[model samples]
Target: MKLSGIFSDGMVLQRNAQVILRGQCSVGGQTVQVVFREVITCTDADPSGNWEVQLEELAPGGPDELVITAGEEKLVLRDVLVGDVWVLAGQSNMELPVRRTLDRLAEEVRGLDLPMIRQFVVPQSYDFHGPRENLDSGAWVPATPEGLLGFSAAGFFFAKKIYERYGVPIGLIQTAVGGTPIEAWISEPTLRRIGGYEATLEQCKDDAYVQSTKQRDEDRNGQWYARLNEADTGLREGWHQAEGEAAGWSEFEVPGSWAGSELESLRGAVWFRKEIDVPVKMTVGEVQLALGTIVDADDTYVNGVLVGNTGYMYPPRRYTVPQGVLKPGKNTLAVRVITTHNTGSFVRDMPYKLKAGGQELDLRGPWKYRVGAVTEALEPQTFFHYMPAGNFNGMIAPLRRFPIAGVLWYQGESNTGQPAGYADRFQAMIQDWRETWGIGEFPVIAVQLANFGPEGEQYTDWAELREEQRKGLAVPRSALATAIDLGEYNDLHPQDKKTLGERLALSARRLAYGETELVASGPMFARMERQGDALRLHFTEVGGGLTTRDGNALQGFSVYGPDGTFVPAQAFIDGDTVVVRQEQLNPPVHVRYAWSNNPAKANLYNREGLAALPFTTEA
Candidate 1:
């Protein structure tokens, strides 16, 4: 009988835990025997030929062999190691590759080669039903340059750190899909147990849901492709030729967005033409054009020759124009930008210039433009329907027989708006995973949401969501890495995944590796005390003493009075406690730290350089 995709010879199982051995056998096979070590256990195969046997917990050290005997066939599984395993799940940032961050991909992989680190990427799939029994396709691959490029950047970095410290094989099971909500990755049963998910599930069940939703998306994609063909056809047929005298076009910045300018809420293809007068003394060999980032996609041409192009947004603008593309006199630089959703400007604060030889050419000016075509508004479509059990069935279910150490997660961005119920949902998901694995309180470390967007005086959902993540530490054997200081205001997907990964490893070292002396987390709010005309906030995990991350004064602390109005409070570090005082309120009723969307000066930290976890004292 053929074995499942997860069942392989050189596999690692969770050490010193209830190991479950499961597989499919031929129909009508009465009995199946599973042998590990010197002990053999026999169990009857089910009617459909499915069989499962739970092996008693064994010691950690292993080079064990598992033999399965069914009917006349004998299958041998060898070279299995016993160590820790973890699951890394999240959205695009967690799914981002190291290759995209640092340009030196080959160098990064060469330094990251570790045989003990193995990763399995769960094939992307979605279903409304509960977890599935098996995934479509996936296998365990060692951490090599070629293999690491496709693995989750955060997960790979975290696993590498842990493997180096613990000297154990690390199995990383990646079950993440980009642009998916938390509800889609969780089980259906788990979602129903939590509120609000029922409404989302109902929306998924609508009869006309798929058709109505995908209509605008289809139109936008179709229009862009059609416009590209039309442009190509025009170029070939001399349609752009002027009858007598062609009016000169002005020059504009090549790579910036056109939304706030002449274009108003327009998406689709737009053509921008710029004329640059080449200096007579300039001996241009190679030219570099920095177009910043186009909203969706862009194809650039210089002197009627194709120079460079980008297929999507998010990539930084740095396209090189080969040495021979420039001319001596007048040069025409044209760009075709295709946008599906949002505005049509190249993102701001990015490089947008051209360089020839050692001389720099500033391309940040006005440019003449014309509309290629007006396409339909691009509507959001749920191409990958997120459903409970869908990910489990396709991504995680097949790995039941394989052993693992624990779980490391860097998610929660998708569920930010529903912060009130995120704690329970996250708890239930963790418990469900633990129950499925039959592992008791396996160490799970998660990265708290980093500070993002503009800082504001008013409360934000992202803050509340981060507080919920902090609340999750109340669950047994769980730790969170605070990344409040590591986020970028403009970029949601920050490029500094290395720090996030290392911080997670720090938690694992303390929790799983028995590093008792190591401080794994920042100071967490423990209890609050009311003093005369002031509120004193205490903290747990006050390693050594409390300190500020920067030399400046502490920020992000807010005090609320009886009326629930929060005002900026004067805060000072008093030993391990934070002293909060507001002249408006004689006695503060509530206190909050790192409460805003992006706290510009939230410098609360421990002596260990770890940023303090965000929290509220309302409860």
Candidate 2:
């Protein structure tokens, strides 16, 4: 006899619910007995070697053991707790670990010792055929300092808040992968019903086609990189070394994209060099070098030695410079960047400095750069794991038998490409999950797409995606946590996960824990009224009445008349309502707030400090 991998040591069973224990027996028709808290339950294995037994409702408390036996085979599960279990699902933002958020939330979790909070990191896998009966590999780990490094940042903070408030052991099932779209998380039947994904799914199912695509991608990438390395003059002449004079290099500003510059259309290897003067007092011990974030890949060298390197972007580039790497006088820093796809850029608004012994040296000025090698842009690879229903079948299906208190979803970045159909797809995925789990409408706290893209550049697609996410609130027992104010303009994965987690926990308190007295959400658009020449916009969930983030005039409001021309309008908060008007135009026929991709001026908020949801009053 053997139990499912999920039924193991350090696992948490759902409290106050009839949870099922599953396993397999070699001998068909053999009785499998389970014992927990003096309660014994038995079930016979079928011809397929599968056996299942249900336990009575268990209360919240444990560090207990579970015993199961069939014939001469016996398995024991130790240190199992009984409390709340939550499924954490989504794309990269949801999969981003606590290590990435350390720069922002380090102080909050410095000495945390919440062993009661545990997480089961589901190994990343995908399948095109059908749902998986069991996971290939996974284990339940507690929230120790070391283990917390791999825990999902958003999920960790949410679990921390819940455990602190209710004092119940929290179990998190992390099943998320980077760069995956919403359709990839839905079931095959649901995707077929929704349509538009049949062709991709069909293509993914063919073994030959998948193999050929992967092989082609490999060959293309290998050839491109090989040619670039061979033609790179910088490598032959030792451009990364400080001994080189670096002649024939042009001045380029740091922390900016190569777009609109001489290197805009080029795709290849580029080398950057910078000089800095260090004080003797600051070079006594090890120093910290932060290059913010880079696009694609980069290999950075301090002085003449390689200090650190990062493959691909998205993660902050932080490296530790040893004591011997720095000198008392002038030092040279060189970086070799490789642009595999898209534009090569050093993102703005991020830390670019060297810190040591409480001293800092800013590394954000013009640097001399030279083209090492130029080549064609690398062809994109087909990620089969991102195919529709692939992740759901392999990752989510295996966890269906496990009971969960609720779900925390932080996806939508990948689906912004086609924002129009996101609402239907999102709502359908929610319904599909509930039906598949055979659970009544459990609370679903979804995080709306946060602000992204360059400032002043209107990304209507992202705004439409946020609106689509907002529509998910129409489903019963669902909550939308507004994140417009919590996003970084340059970074897709924002560092302010603490505030986002707090917002999600607020919704969990109200919807899941029955804390109706709590204010869970920000101001939501209720209705629009045209009074005389101006328009009056009303709102719901005005916690403690309406207010503004900045104590200034209302912004991010626009109006359009019959001509369909939208102009910036002056707005003011009057009690719980906002009045908007544009003096130069006819009486406004439609209105919208914070509709831009990066609405830097959108400061409308409630007294609780939660930003108002972005919305438009059209149709």
Candidate 3:
């Protein structure tokens, strides 16, 4: 007999709730018994060799053992605890680990030990067949200085904060996948009821179609990279070596894109070299190289020795320089960047330096660069894992029997382009998840999309999606965490997950823990009234009353008239309302606040220091 993959040593069962123990016997018609805390439950294995024993409700706190017996076989699980288990779900933002946040929270996280905080990371898997009965692999790991690096940043902080306030052990089930959309996490039945995804799901369900698409993508990309490598002059000439340095390399500014530059249109390999002067004291201890973020892929080398390589873009380029890699004097830093697309550039507004102990060496400014090879832009590949019901089948479905306190959702960037139906779809998915677990109206703490993109861009898709997320609050026992002011304009994966997690914890306090008096949400738009050419907007949840974040004049407000053209409007606080006026917009019909992709000027906040949610009066 063998227990489910989720049941093992160091596992944490839900506290103050009836826990279901499930396993598969070696043969059918066998008696399976589960003994936990001296409470015995027995059941017979069905024809499929599957058996389940539902245990009575358990209280918090444990270092207990769970014993399961099937016929003559016996299994013992050690170091099990009864705690509050929360499912962390969504896309890359939720999947991003604590190690990525160390660049900003290193001092706070270093040497920290919290054994009560544990996590079972669900392996990245997808299946179009049906819901899985068991996870292929998973294990519970407690928070330690070493183990904490792999824990989800948002989930960890949320757990830490919740534990601090409630004094309950926290167990996190990480089921998030990077770059996946909400549709991927919804069940097949849910997707069918939601409709419009039939064609996509049908194509994905076919084994032949899936295999053919994978083969085609592999062939196309394999040939392109192979050809580019063969033609790369840098590799042929050994440009990574100090002795192989060649002349005629053009000078370019660091921390900037290649657009409008000498290598603007190049769509292949490019070699960049920079020389840095290092001190003996700085090279003595641990040394780290921070290249911020790079476009596409990159293989970085220091002193002719490869330090690190990232396959794709989006991840910050942080590499550890070996003790002997940096010398007392001049050291060579070389990077071979591979751009599948023509847009090869170093991202701006990120760290670009090398650090040793407390000393530093700035690797920014000018760098010598040369084109290695040129090729056509690689075609975009399809991700079968993002199809509807795949992740639900492989990642989420197996955990239905496992009880959870609630869910922490931090997605929606992938579906921003089609924001119109997001509200209905999000609500439907929430209901589906609750029904799947047989948990009635469990609290769901959903994060609104953070502010993003260039300031000059006029895209309102993100804003519209935020409104859709707000609409999701119509569901019972749900809360929305606003992240409008927490994002960087240049980076999609923001590093400040601590604040966002704190916001999620606040939501959990009110929605899940029954903290009725707590102000957990930001100011929400309630109603609007038009007075001639100006509009007065009222808001709810104005904890300690509404105010500006920066103590300056209220901004990010706009007015629109019959022409449907929004113009910048002057706004100021009047009692509990915000009055917006645009002289040119006569008989204004609508008003909006923080309606752009990156509404940098949006500073409205409350006394509790939470930014107001983005909204449009037209809704």
Full-model lDDT for every candidate: 0.74, 0.89, 0.89
Candidates, ranked, lDDT: 3, 2, 1
Please give, for residues 432-522, the per-residue lDDT of candidate 2 as tens digits.
8898777689888999888888777966888888889888778888999988998898888998888988899999999999999888888
Residue 65 of model 2 has an lDDT of: 90
Range of the 10 consecutive residues with the lowest summed lDDT in candidate 3: 238-247
What is the Cα-based TM-score of model 3?
0.98
Give the worst 10-residue stretch by lDDT in candidate 2.
Answer: 1-10
Q: Given candidate 2, what's the lDDT at residue 571?
A: 96
TM-score, every prediction: 0.83, 0.96, 0.98
Q: Which portions of model 2 miss their true places by more than 4 Å?
A: 280-286, 327-330
Better of 1 and 3 by TM-score: 3
For candidate 3, the per-residue lDDT at 500 reads 93
Q: How many residue pairs clash in each candidate?
A: 20, 0, 0
Candidate 2 has an lDDT of: 0.89
> How do the residues 1-619 of candidate 1 rate in per-residue lDDT, one tens digit apiece?
5565555655666667777777778765579998888899999988988888887776655567989998986899877666677888777777877665553233555666665677777777665544566655567777775677777778887888877776777777787776665656566666677756576666655647745766766786676677665655334532233221224443355446565666657766677766677764443676777776777788888776777788777766566777666777777777777777777776666566777767766776777766666666565555644554456555665565555667887778877777787777777778877777665677888889888887674657889999888888778889999888888776677767777888999998888888978888889999999998898999988897899877778888899888889889999999889999999886689998988878768998898888899999976
Compared to the true structure, candidate 2 yields what TM-score? 0.96
138-166, model 3: which lDDT tens digit per residue? 89999988799999999999999999988
